[model samples]
Target: MRVASLMNVLGRGWLLAERALQVFHSTARETRALKFNYPKGTFEAWAYMTCMETVSAILSQVSQVTFEDMTSSLLLIRASLWEYGLKKLYKLGEICQLVPTSNAPDENQINRITSGITQQSAGGDSEDQGRLLVATLMSKQQFTSKYLELGEMVIGAFKHAGRKRTACSVGLDMAKFHVELGQIEEAERLLSDMCSLYSPENWTIFSANTISLLAE
Candidate 1:
């Protein structure tokens, strides 16, 4: 019910934002009027996107959510963040510091997302990307779980960007993630999928640089 309520609230915010965009703009006298409601609405879609004050209130409620529900909510929140662009994200980071800011302003969205997930996950089995809120919400699952899912999403987008090998490499990383969790069987499955998606020969070559388990 909490998830549903949150979803409803998010949907209503989006609708209001859409209506705001249609709030009407015109040129009067010596001025041009333009209504850009969706922009703010997008950012406002999730109160916590920039709401440090309500973080406790909302998270207090979400803290009790199941891992499945919590991950779903987090995905929705992340989507809202992306809609606002990385520039705004960096700004939010300035305040809460939980949401990350892109240091390389020139990097594409996929790269930025990948870097965030990598930096956070590398710190240990943490899907929260080094943030207490994320860690708590996702505390039940293996830390690498959410990171892997997000990595795959980025890889899919990268494939459309014309870097097939780079895209496939993420799957290898997914396999590595599984290995770290001591899920050898799961890791092997991912590696096998990567080989089928890419090339057996290339997988063999790429296998050398990563952890030895891939070689096994």
Candidate 2:
């Protein structure tokens, strides 16, 4: 059947429908060519498997594309994961290892995201671009006064755009940075402001994780 039918039935289910469609298309082509013939349902099964492999490869590529999109969009979850890595590195006390490795956030990946943010910020139309820039900067271990100034710029854009969730996130990141710099009162004020503006569900997990760390 059509991919839309699969989507409607499954609700955000991409993998199964993609695989099935791939297999059906391949098998149908094979049948037309008469290059392969099998007993009754056997061909269909083989075709299904072939479709699955093809779809699996496509899905892998799709995932990478999606990751880049999320990074570009500065989605809170993606930013949180990056922040989590920073925390992990801090815990290991190998803060210098924040540079890209062959694994996560390798240097090339960092440069890509950084360049993406710079380009997006220069373009200056989307609130998401600003939020993403803040998230990316916050994920880094070291910051200069300029970075904090940039964080303020992000906060201003989020507020101007009426994005409470993004504003809260920027606030929370500033709070964490302030707390790390021994500016506890400023951090507390920012956290309090965030709590006032955002519901619990809207609070990013990174903020929750930071609270947990602080409580300990």
Candidate 3:
């Protein structure tokens, strides 16, 4: 359940979702009370279902969807960014957030995994469900802007459990996340302060040059 792998599944899931969208033409496809195995569903299952739901609900009445005839739906974009649920989907986000940064996959890896999917896409305005995938990849704190609060919680949890090593790894992940978003100074500060905490197995995979350049 690493972030990267989950995101890749989401990216692929969105591509598969396009097939479902082709079912309706010019009219919205309404799904009422679609009973899913809630909370019991695996992450992959939930992710795909969510992707399908969000896309269908957000852009309905497409006027047409001709998968065979790309020209048929001139207004339709093959790939797009969907901002579904806004900040409302917290439970799902929290479940994902608790996964340790050490185990979670970062966004860059997700991009690499989806590169082939992008190359094969049938030309759309943007990739479908891009933001949704990214949001899922976000740390719970980062996703919800509860960083300071989450930081304290994490520190307290790890310290109470006598897991100083685990604390360092989470801190490193926070630094790396900032780096991914181009927040170099913040990342560097975190890394430097927690330098002694880094073990051979836990430093971020991002290049030293990239880290150094950005930290400056």
Candidate 4:
């Protein structure tokens, strides 16, 4: 899949490249969920993240990017980060003797630990995963700045391309992430920017949920 994605990317087949990445990500998920025939941890979670990052790097090579492209890329990267952090936390638990070592770690235990990490971020949804991932990184209190820098770089790219709605959406997610880390002020600042991007006609359930989170 890696080679396929790279070949497609070189051929300027962006959609095909993304499809390969999706297949790789799905395989990784199935492996983690014990549905795949591969051994547990056969597919490292960071591999998907790295692939997404690589695609993001070459996005500039495309002369034009549509809304769908930007949104899809955003979702792909978000999932990558979530899986990256989730697997990292589980491995860390094993190393620290906080979790039992087994071929397949308990999913419920992972969920419980994730819940305990951040109250407002509890759930299995992508947004929840994103916030949980950020919270986990922040709780470690290491390389927080680097993560933030990468996030801002992505967000800035969207904004620079005049994809305000997409940029605001990602920024809102990033804010919720900060909220999980108890960075209320920074979260509010980002949330404020989100509000301006929404109108009554264009407001969506996601937008409403973000606002509700801010209200809380």
Candidate 5:
């Protein structure tokens, strides 16, 4: 059936994004171990660049999805870019170009996703897919004043939808935006709130390992 096929495609996209995340985390750990002694050598630069390219490739693959479909592939790409220290704003511009401006995925679609998933809890996987889409968009948009306006709309919808995890992620995205704009104090406050939402054990360990790069 068409429904089953669509699910399969979305499932594969999620798997690919997850695999890419693992690769990024492993490379980052190796890079960190060599950080202090890493000479400004061509080989070191090449290695770093190669890792970035891998991340970019995976992101591009996720971007191929239609806006109406699962958004998790896109979110994974954004998170991976963030993890790899890619310039979020620049990437946002690239993604905006990929989707037709008039047809770009919007908060309404996001709301549908939130409502569908949170109501059933059986929709957790689908919720993850939707969050990935929002994360991808946020990564591209950064936390500019315009994005902040959009965030307000998104947060409002999340509150109404009752998806606590997605709401927390939207908050985290806002915090990341503040961090990008050099509002370290505000960003830290947002991050503190985010940390309070989940068990410390469930936080992505790979993210903690790459904190230095992400901070940069």
Candidate 6:
């Protein structure tokens, strides 16, 4: 049936994203070890650049599907920032070593690199796909703002669809992201706002999770 086929396609996208995440994590660990041992050298620089490429691939794969998946979007944002940091290190190593300048990435270059993946997707909003592809190339400050904006949009979509609990859950996740970024006041305000949506008869888990996060 059409429903089964759609689910299969979605599941395939998620599976690819998940597998990419695993590879990225493993590559990151190896690169970290290389950095710790060599500090600043050709091998370390090479390892780091490779690791970043893997991270970029994960973002590319995720964007090939729906940007509506909060986990994939969050991971891409996090990995984007991490890539920024790693790139700085790579540049620093370039001064002392013949680091691979050819591998240096710019926004346009990354966009081109991911264009094939974006073209492969048969579903999801084109506008949202554009936003996600843009997100993968953004710097830390840019991605943080963009992601928060996306979280709000996704929450609105959930609310409009009468998925109040899902919306509240996403709001909590966004608040947690704020906390992770050390925006404590923003996190507190978000949690407070989300509280107004929860009641005794609904979203009980949201209240408990919000309270637990606030307590932290």
TM-score of 2: 0.31
lDDT of 3 at 22: 44
Q: Pick the TM-score winner.
A: 4
C-alpha lDDT score of every prediction, in listed order: 0.41, 0.45, 0.41, 0.52, 0.45, 0.51
Candidate 3, residues 111-147, lDDT tens digits: the string is 4423433443332213454344444445544543543
After superposition, candidate 5 runs with Cα above 4 Å error: 1-143, 199-216
Candidate 6 vs. true structure, TM-score: 0.42
lDDT of 1 by residue, 1-216 (tens): 243235335643332322222221121111333444332222321232222222222444455665356444343333323222222333333332222122322223323433443453433213332353334223224223434555555455444444556556666756665665578888887766565555644755655544344577
Q: Estimate each model's TM-score.
A: 0.34, 0.31, 0.29, 0.48, 0.29, 0.42
lDDT, residue 202, model 2:
62
Better candidate by TM-score, 1 or 6 = 6
lDDT of 6 at 12: 44
Tens digits of per-residue lDDT for model 5 on 27-57? 6587778775532222222222333444344
Over 5-89, each residue of candidate 4 has an lDDT whose tens digit, in order, gives 4554575445554454576668667766886563232243234234444454345455486545655565454444433433444
User: How do the residues 150-216 of candidate 6 rate in per-residue lDDT, one tens digit apiece?
Assistant: 5675566555545567667777867877876778998898788678778644778767777777888
lDDT of 1 at 185: 87
Best of the candidates, lDDT: 4
- Give model 5 RMSD, 1 decimal: 16.3
- Provide the lDDT at 137 for model 3: 43
lDDT of 2 by residue, 76-159 (tens): 322332233223223222222232221233444345444444453422223343344334434444323534554565565455
lDDT, ranked from best to worst: 4, 6, 2, 5, 3, 1
